[model samples]
Target: MSPRWKWKGAEAKALAEPISKTVSILQSSLTRTEASGLLSNHNVLLSVEAEQAELLDRSCFGRPVVACAEKEDKRWIQLTFEEAFFLFYNLNCIKISLHGRRLENEVELWRFVRSIKPNFATSYKAYSHLRLKNWIVRPGLQYGVDFVVYRHHPSLVHSEFAVLVKSVDGNDRLRVWSDSHCSVRLTGSVAKTLLVLYINGEEVNREDMNLPLCLEDYTVEEVTVRRWSPELNREHDLSL
Candidate 1:
């Protein structure tokens, strides 16, 4: 059997297969999530046999890594913080360890993740939201977006939309006209629509908010940002 992760409308063969095993991600371990806010399925190290390496290379489940080909080398699959938390909170498939200590529960894990990721709440909401829709959300830093959502596994099809999480509260100082101008053009060039996901809700106290499951309390709205070029939309004088 493969990893145990599943979701609504998920296909068995190509989805993120969560394994029933303890995945120890050391604090020192390098993962794709750090450098890029996006994730890939190449981090979580597993306890598979040498022969299984050949099989893992073909599936989206895992990828075999051989740094130096030492006899003591262990195989692993990598997961971003969002992916790791999803498995733990939603599916309860794998246990997480940071620097040799196991994160006992979601609360503990949340606290730990918060210490590292400042935008954990907003990004996670967007991540989980897309996930429930059966869209595969992957890293989109390359496209200058928070995420690139795929209709299916990334390898099977192109991502239809690029998402950027923003807040509806205040003037949203992070966004400006120039940013929108650049983002729309960048996404358009790649054939992906830019979606500005606006999150709104009551502001929660950080001291206590991070302690509870408050993702449901927030509301998410998606606005598609498209380029308007009059040259392409010109109305011809057919009557003349």
Candidate 2:
């Protein structure tokens, strides 16, 4: 006969204890009015301070307080200011790889990511340009850039560049589709192209803007977009 699996209630309780403690601490730090303001800012619709406190108390027990209260005809207490900030802080700890692929839920991650790094698309483009320059770069949410690259030489200026990264395939197609599926046309003859290059900590400019004419042109490889996975969603603590 196969052995029976046992539920680890104790372990579950132990894990929940810390979260409860944290919530209690946060509640104690604020007054009723402040707590109400916090919830209001996070779009939580609470009728009274007492209701908000009750929700916080329930959260510690790993209960779906918002959902449960709604079911009971009680308006859900929105996430308190402290709670919202802490939640976002915890979310940024999740690592995002290049090509916008997260080992976790991209949508969930994007919500937190967008909250913290609103200009994600632009930063992504700047990172791509830097990557082509052969500098090792990764997403820099803390610095508010799409990426962070290590400087190999001291002579190179340590500066951040604003980048605009767009989905070449999707945006183009979407634009045309929205415009009654009509094809877009390119205007004007090419006069001159400018090539901007970064080599050994120096920016080199050239008249002809072609990859072959650039001082150091490296082929950029595309990173495949990741799909949402149910297993990954189950692993993360997405209380919502």
Candidate 3:
């Protein structure tokens, strides 16, 4: 009985709403029913609009939800709380049901997620910036980072970068050399660049305060790391 959207008939109310159809929250992952509903309906929208949308890339407009493999012929629209919040805040998609009642607005969603992770505000700011850049961002827990960013939809290409968000305030501690090295190498192994994003701003005391508005006042720096080795750096001879 976690929060879910109630859609009546065939088409969805909004472009992003289709992704919320039949969604249920368990543990922190958002799951969507795979049978005929928003998923199928969304595909039809893509088909019908494919020609009209030629001026813009139709692939990017479908839905932002990610489907994780559950079993044979089955997949779930699993997303992290941060990812869900991003969709809610940026796209205004997905109606959440909490305790059988719908939450009023983004503020309620912010408070709910903040209760789960106190560091949500900082991460949300960083996430919104990256999303605004048109990068496909996803939770990067397995990679020991905050997000994995792809140049395009994941279905179209592999993620190109792993992002780690760090506070820029003087109180924040420096990352361990070994940990940084490991993260860089791991991301390289998977064909992704490691990007460390530093969020510069004073910490906020109220969850009700708009985080996105404050993002404009904050500065972020992107740092990419790479391993340098003599073997890897060796130059190859060219045939005349």
**Candidate lDDT values, in order:** 0.61, 0.32, 0.54
Summarize candidate 3's per-residue lDDT along 1-240 as a digit string, tens digits. 111223432123333432222121211221121111121211211111222122112223323223433334333343456555654556554455465566677676666666667677778778878867766577788988788876554544567888888884432423578787788789888778888888887665464344446655678888887777778556745342
Query: How well does each candidate superpose onto the true structure, as a TM-score?
Result: 0.69, 0.20, 0.60
* Residues forming the 10-long window of minimal summed lDDT in candidate 3: 33-42
Tens-digit lDDT track for model 2 on 1-240? 111113335334434444345444535533323432112212323332445445444432111245544344343344322233333222221122223333243344334433554433233334435533534343334433233343221122232221213342223222333331111111001111111121221232322221112222423333322234598789577895
Candidate 1 overall lDDT versus native: 0.61
Task: Report, for all candidates in order, the number of backbone clashes.
Answer: 12, 1, 1
Model 3: per-residue Cα lDDT at residue 191: 76
> Candidate 2 lDDT (Cα, whole model)?
0.32
The stretch of ten residues in a row with the least summed lDDT in candidate 1 is 19-28
lDDT of 1 by residue, 72-163 (tens): 53444555667666655764555666555666678877777767776777878888787666566788888877888766555445678989
Best model number under lDDT: 1
Runs in model 2 lying further than 4 Å from the true structure: 1-103, 136-240
Candidate 2 at 24: error in angstroms? Answer: 44
